[model samples]
Target chain A: MCKKPLIDLHDDKLFITFEGELTLYTIANIEKALAYVKTYSFNALQLDFQDVTFLDTAGALFIYNLEKYFTKKEIAVTLLLEDTTQKDTLNLIKENMKSSHKSVPRKQKSFLEQTGELFYNYYIGLLSFLHFFGKLFTTNLRYITSLKNIRFKEIAFEINESAIRALGIIALTSFLIGLVVAYQSAYQLKIYGANIFIVDMLGISIFRELAPLITAIVIAGRSGSAYAAQIGAMKITQELDAMKTMGFEPFAFLVLPRIIALVITMPILIFVADMMAMLGGLIVANIDLNITMELFMDRFSEVIAAKHFYVGIVKGPFFAFLIAAIGIYRGLKVKDDTQSIGFNTTKSVVESIFAVIVCDAVFSIAFTNLGI
Target chain B: MEFIKVRDVRTVLGDKIVHDGLNLTINEGEIYGLLGPSGCGKTTLLREMVLLQEFTSGSIELLGKRLETISERDAQSLRHQWGVLFQFGALFSSLTLKENVALPLIEYTELSEKMIDEIVRFKINLVGLKTEDANLYPSEISGGMRKKAGLARALAMDPKLLFLDEPTSGLDPISAREFDSLILKLRDMLGLTIVMVSHDLQSIYDTLDKVAIIDNKKIIYEGTLQEVTNVKNDFIESFFGKMK
Candidate 1:
């Protein structure tokens, strides 16, 4: 039940009467009515608002923009206001419109500029990670000297979360890997009447490389991302700041417990994974190579050296340290946004898994060079 | 002119009965305040009004459409008719203030980018935020600025009805008063029917034209502050007693 503005053109002058609420909802209809006025030749435009019931910011802005449009065409304009309140609104909107004209839109970056920014961000990230690592190292050293400074309860909770809960998935994945490796080797060994060689292949690969690598990768995805997300969320909600205010170093309180728990549980988890893998290989050998379980165990103990087990288990702590450190480092790097938590969690997983594989490669080269 | 009418709304959140037989009417062009004690489901009622929460029974007629049975298309169109400002300024953390304000316009309308930019600048200025603040993310700004940015985004579509949840809670006295005045000015200029949930007494007294005090799972009083002050209720007595 709103009346459209009446437009009448007489000689060189134009008269317009506005009625009802001249707000955002009605402004569109007013625009359609005025669309015909642009075709007429008028030197002076008179906007009569004596009967207008209401005028909002958008309405005021529309009138202001209409005046500007006519004035740019060298046509003069006059506004007849019925109320002081409407006049005040129009003036308020007019003032804001003038100030808003100064705001520049964000500029687009060129390809080179974007590339340069990417490189610069990576450099800064590297430096920050190094600083975080140094702080973590020194905090661990200082806290390790004092037994009471460590939070044993929190460490236990973390172990339950990262290690104990992860057993089922790790067991399944390691068993499957062991079965596939033994089956593949047995196929080729049986061709040469060397089906017993499957034991040597399964033992060396599953114990020295596959078990440790798979376990680290799984833990990296599971516990590493959890660490980053937990710490990052805490940072976002300012809980880290709260801890700092209460004289608790976040490194000692949040990061150390996670790192210690992961380190202690990692070797133990890897050892279980190694045993499960050997059992899987034993089954495969018994099934495909006609070797009995007792016979396979006898050959396995004779051939599989203790050094292979040591090499795989030794890398467990290093992989754990890398995953936990990267996770915490990424978590601390989270800025004041929820999206940063997601981004950092993803980065934590990717970086930790990458670091684990690279460290494994280095270990392989070193052990090979030393004739281990 | 009746923008919203809640009739016998019964809300049960889990086993806890949040509201029973709640009824209120919000007329057009009035700053209506929903005042209550803590844990009285004031925010819950606001959420229910905005369609973020559901009621067990009865009807909430917003803009003449019953909320419980409103179709998806009707709900979508009705949503475009009102703007909601959450308590914590619920701004997108990733986007800058300008982009945050422009999101609704970009998603709903076919306006040109240049036009959207102009409208964004106007809204940012209208809310008393500096032009330079447009480039900064929500996390970079203070609580007051974030609320202002949120208000700006809420107003971007130039909606007829506005809903504000505790708009002055986290602000300093000066900023809070400024916010109250801004609310008054926006209502006057835009002809907006505002439904605000507020615990701030000063804000309620300064800005509200009418108020509905909810206590004990139902509205204890619904009228002007002067009339509400005369009501014989423990909550009303303690709430307004602080005015002394």
Candidate 2:
């Protein structure tokens, strides 16, 4: 049940009696009462809380604010209270309110200022990333000299999690991609009476570009984001700090194992993806272009160069390094919040994929220039 | 008025029995403490009272609503009548302390943003947090400040009942005492029927009006701190023995 405050206006004095529950549920009615009182020009205002059966913090706040509202207009405000607890609440709120001043509003930034801030943040971020990269590089280099400190068990576990677990998805994705590419090219090649050229097209594209790129993107999405979330959660829970206090280098213990595992597994995963893609292409070629599997292998041996396979497989480690490095880097960059874990995980995936593509592009250009 | 009455409450989590025939009564305007050694299911009973966890076979009547047979509508309304402060503050890491304090009012009431802002600031200050800390996120504040901010949010709704899970567990002695006083002050100021799960002996001595000591799947003692020593229980002896 809700009760509206009884308002009495006589001459220059306004008296209001609040009744029943004075809580969030009844605040709207109290606000209406305040609105009614505001219409009158009163030099003196008395708020009677004796009839108020229930008064919570919100209600006390309203009473306090109402007193402040009329007092600011140079009116005398007096609060009449019979209930000791209500009086204590009002007094507590009043005392606390004295210490809490209004926070200064943030100044709006102009367009140029906003742009400068954005650029500055990115610049700082780039510097931090480079620092992390260098630190990790030196740590790995130092560990290479003394291999006893390295946790091979962690590395093995990470390989199992990031690589061995990823095998099924990799196989399915590469197979579908290979099938689609061969099917699309087979339609065109068949029209030109060049059904045999399907092997050359699939071999060049899948081996040199499609397989490596797809495998990298998959790992970046799968393992890169996971690395970021795992490390970020650890950082949030102060496990990284615990590791440091225990005299263990986090990069070596956490990041290095992931990077080493990915580097070891990436080429293996890509090689598997390569075989699966060829298998898919073989089936498509057989069904679509009426080419026999033996004939496809014979043409493939003749047209597909070892150099194409080398180009694809060689990019695997680089791509893996980029994915794992960026993942761990972004993870280390995570601030002390759950939101930052999600934020960094997203950034890790996007940045690693971008880095993989850029590295692939650079490799393609360098190989072209070297006449390889 | 009996604000909470837990009767014949039994909890079976998988194969482990947490609570068996646990019964307790918390009255209005009393600061109640659920005391037990670690893993005695004190928090579980608190959670069960708040409807966060379910007891296997029991009746928990909170604010005149039976928990097991409560309708969805009644459950929603009952939730509004109480506020829970989880362990570790549990402030939404994404929102600042001000936004966190303002959340319940914004969701439950039709108060304008201006009024809500005033209430939020008042609640923030009422819990002894600085005005400047209002803009900072939960992660930005210290442990004591986080607990205070959490108290602000819990009191945001001006609930009649408050459930706090370990309000002073992680604080230093000074801050812990400060928290104890804050709890006492809030209980007096707001007339809140507080049910807190705590193992802090000093906190138990300072703030609790009545306590139910849970040990070995049942309440070993339920009375004031002054009368607690009369109970013959190993947990009560070891737990409150240090105080003596």
Candidate 3:
């Protein structure tokens, strides 16, 4: 069929003369003709069905769709059915509309019914997870392709400000944490005349858990919150939309850079946190036990194996992913309301921290079993 | 000739049908206004036409290609043909007006910095903003100036099709009128096909070649301004009445 033509009505009313059978075969012809006539301004569509030799349910369904389309636009469609074949089709449409109008008032449910409905919805939601998963999988390639344009400078700024900016505070906290762990362990060791092994205790704790967990927590609050707030505010004000409207994918332009930045920088920060905690432990070992800095270092290297270092570093990127995922998810989920930006930012940080803790525990436990 | 054709688009956000089989045909180089009250889904429909929205069912064709079926790379490249000015004058707060206007050229093309700067300056001048105004960020500029800056950015791409959402909103009467004149001048100079979502009747009448009014989740009126002006319906009359 030819592309639809613009139909202009010259008067308040016009005649639509249909000169063919209203059968299944002729439905396509009728629709083609109607498409051309529907493009322009019109008041009413007059259907001339006198020449129609036959009409079936398919033809009836086509007309029903047309009537619904026109009616919603406030344009009336009048059926001029003169043939017996057309009469049955028109009658069927009228009856369908009447029955739909009478369908039990779309009954409001009782509490029990509502509960049942909620359960049913939840079941359907479980089934619909595949749909969500499929969309994400299909869109993953596009997301990856956007990585090409991510300026390294943009990523560096995001990472440096987000993860590195909190370094001083993290170091301070790690120092206190190290001192406390060392002192507590020394007290317990003193009870058994094994106070000298405090070096092993502080070193193991810092490398294995304290440093990684503390650094992850710091990032979840600082970098993750910033990412969410920035993106969320951009979304609320339509800067993200502006990018899309200008032919730049918002995911590529705004999101990918931050993801790259966090991924690159998180491990580096964890390394810093580990060093600070070790230094704090060294201080405790020297002052409390009268051990030299050199001696403490020698024992720390001996007790904390390469596995601990690898484990901590591995968790950094995973934690980064958790932060980026939560941050971007919360940002993308923000509503148009300006207040939601701050709210979502807070939500992202909390969710990131929670997710990090859970994932870290799972990873540590699984690795402990594997003895990695 | 119809440059953009929407064929029976039916869109729903979950349960609510925002566009119930909405259809529109916009011709080239004409200013078409999608006029409606808030919540009538004019923006949703425009977004659908531009392929920014996914419809539950129906088809959209722009410049002879089926919108839904087009390759994303093609979509991105073809999108250069249209420029959208979002409702809030969505400028990057981090960037100055010149940088904002130059963004598209920088993103879409391999233009050198100097050439991009000259184009950005030309666009800023076209929107009636001074050269000095180009250095100011969106937060530093007046709301009216921001809107003009948005228009300048939209024009920077030199798009054949331009989409605008509430261009006259939040502007003083003079600024609104000035915007209307600038739109007319742009259309005259570039022969741009403009589609805008607006509730402002005065702006609609001043710049539109045709106005499509959305009501009850459908297009209630589509015609010349004079035809809409002559409409006697209470809502239609009151809309024009307020402008008068």
User: Quick one: best lDDT, which candidate?
Assistant: 1
Interface RMSD in angstroms for candidate 1: 15.3
lDDT of 2 by residue, A1-372 (tens): 577778898888888887788898889866975675677887998888888898889988988888888889999988889999988988999998999998989999999999999999999999999999899888888787887767798899999999999999999999999999998999899889999999999999999899999999999999999999988887775455423322246887788999999999998999989999999999999999999989999999999989999999999999999999999999999987899999999999999999999999999999889987
Pairs that collide, model 2: none
Docking class of 3: medium
Residue B149, model 3, lDDT: 92
For candidate 2, give the lDDT: 0.88
Using DockQ as the measure, the top candidate is 3
Each model's lDDT: 0.89, 0.88, 0.80
Name model 1 segments beyond 4 Å from true. Answer: A1-41, A46-56, A79-88, A99-101, A107-113, A182-195, A284-291, B1-244
**lDDT for position B130 in model 2:** 89
DockQ metric for all predictions: 0.01, 0.02, 0.50
| Model 3 per-residue lDDT tens digits across residues B98-182 | 9999988987789999999999999999999999999988999888899899999988889999999999999999999999999
- Write one digit per residue (lDDT tens) for candidate 1, span B92-156: 67579998889778767899999999999999999999999999998899999999998998898
User: DockQ score for model 1, please?
Assistant: 0.01
* TM-score of the B chain in each candidate versus the native B chain: 0.99, 0.98, 0.94
Ranking by TM-score: 3, 2, 1
iRMSD, per candidate, in listed order: 15.3, 15.5, 1.2
